[model samples]
Target: MKALIISDSHGWTHELKTIIDRHRNQVDVIFHCGDSELSENDEALKGVNVVRGNCDFGDDFPEELIESVGGVTFFVAHGHHYNVKMTYVPLSYRAEEHQANVTCFGHSHVATAFMENEVLYINPGSIRLPRQHPQGTYCICEYDEKEISVTFFNTHGENIPELTVAFKRK
Candidate 1:
């Protein structure tokens, strides 16, 4: 299965729409890690699995989401509640509690992906205001029975090859 993960669009609905249109057919799921700053019912988020960020005031948005796809369990959160900017420990603990195979979050605006204790953690960065990288970015993750491959792409849809990674699934 394949998934597209993005976060921190901060109200750029047009961009979100473009991204959805671009990858809708290629991915089985699309997730927004939060801070979309748009209403939960916005057309731009029609088929997306979205969580609420610190900046999001929509009561309709959930604080976290748990989804199962292609036998993989994913825990999605905005990260601010877990203090992810300083450490992943809090988030890691939560993922353990949920028995999640992967955890997706965004808050620091810095893209990163890694595996810890068999759980994959991914932050797709901010498409509106990225940090520690030249271009704002998102991520595409593909997984099968053996491994998961992740590729980061800038807002313009260009892949950032240096950020691509693959890991063995537990």
Candidate 2:
């Protein structure tokens, strides 16, 4: 299965629509880590999975969520509540509690993807306002029963070669 992960859009509906149009049917799932700031009525996310961020005021979105896909469990959150900018301690603990194979979040506006102890952790950065990096970014995860591969993509929709990572299921 394949998944498109994005976060911290901060209300860039037009860009979000472009991204959805490009990957909607190609991936098995779409994850929005939050700060969408878009109304639920917007059709840009007809079938996307999303969580709320601190900036997504009054949106009725949950602070965290869990989902199972292709035999893998995913823990999704906005990261601020967990103090992501400081460290991953709290988030890692939460992932362990949730027994998640993958943990995804957004808050720092920086893209990161790595695996530790057979678990995948990803931050898709911001599509609207990136910090410390000029390029806006997102991530794609491809997995089956044996292995998984992750790739980060820039705003131009080009993959960042050096940011790719491959993992074997333990």
Candidate 3:
């Protein structure tokens, strides 16, 4: 299965819509790591799995979300509450506690993808206001029962190969 992962859009629904439309059928799942700022009433995210960002104030959202697709579990969070800008400690521990195969998050506005202790950690960066990196970016993860492969792409749709990672289940 292929999953599209994005974060920190911060209400740029139009951009999000365009990207989604471009990859609709190629992606089996859409994961939003947060900063959507838009209400649940926004129909652009009809089938997305979203977590509440620090900026998402409504009671309708949750701080974290865990989803199981194609027999793999994904733990997603917006990162602020996990102190992601400073360290990955709490977030890594949380992933361990949940026994999640992959953890996706955003808040640092810097893209990253890596595997440690058999768990994948991914941050797709900010789509609206990129920092550190020259361009805004998102990620696409392809996985099956045996392995997972992740590829990051900048706003211009070019693959950011340095941010890619592939893992084989132990």
The candidate scoring highest on TM-score is 1
Instruction: Residues 58-136, candidate 1: write the lDDT tens digits.
Output: 5978999999998889999999999999999999999999999889999999999999999999999999999999898
Go through the candidates in order and give the C-alpha RMSD of each one to the true structure. Answer: 0.9, 1.2, 1.4
lDDT tens digits by residue: candidate 3, 1-170:
78899999898888887777767789878998999888777776767888889888886567898888877789999999899999999999999998998899998988888888988899999888888888889989988878889998886678988778888877
TM-score of each: 0.97, 0.95, 0.93
Cα misplacement distance, residue 39 of candidate 2 (Å) = 1.8
lDDT of 3 at 150: 91
- Pairs clashing in candidate 3? none
Stretches of candidate 1 exceeding 4 Å from the true structure: none
Comparing 1 with 2 on TM-score, the higher-scoring candidate is 1
lDDT of 2 by residue, 1-170 (tens): 88899999988888888987788888988999999987667787668888999889875678898999887799999999999999998999999999998999999998888887677999988988987678898889998788888888887789888777788876
Extract clashing residue pairs from model 2.
none
Question: Candidate 3's C-alpha lDDT?
Answer: 0.87
Q: How many Å off is the CA of 139 in candidate 2?
A: 1.0
| Model 3: how far residue 110 lies from native, Å | 0.9
Question: Which parts of model 3 have CA positions greater than 4 angstroms off?
Answer: none
Candidate 2 global CA lDDT score: 0.87
Worst 10 residues of 1 by lDDT: 161-170
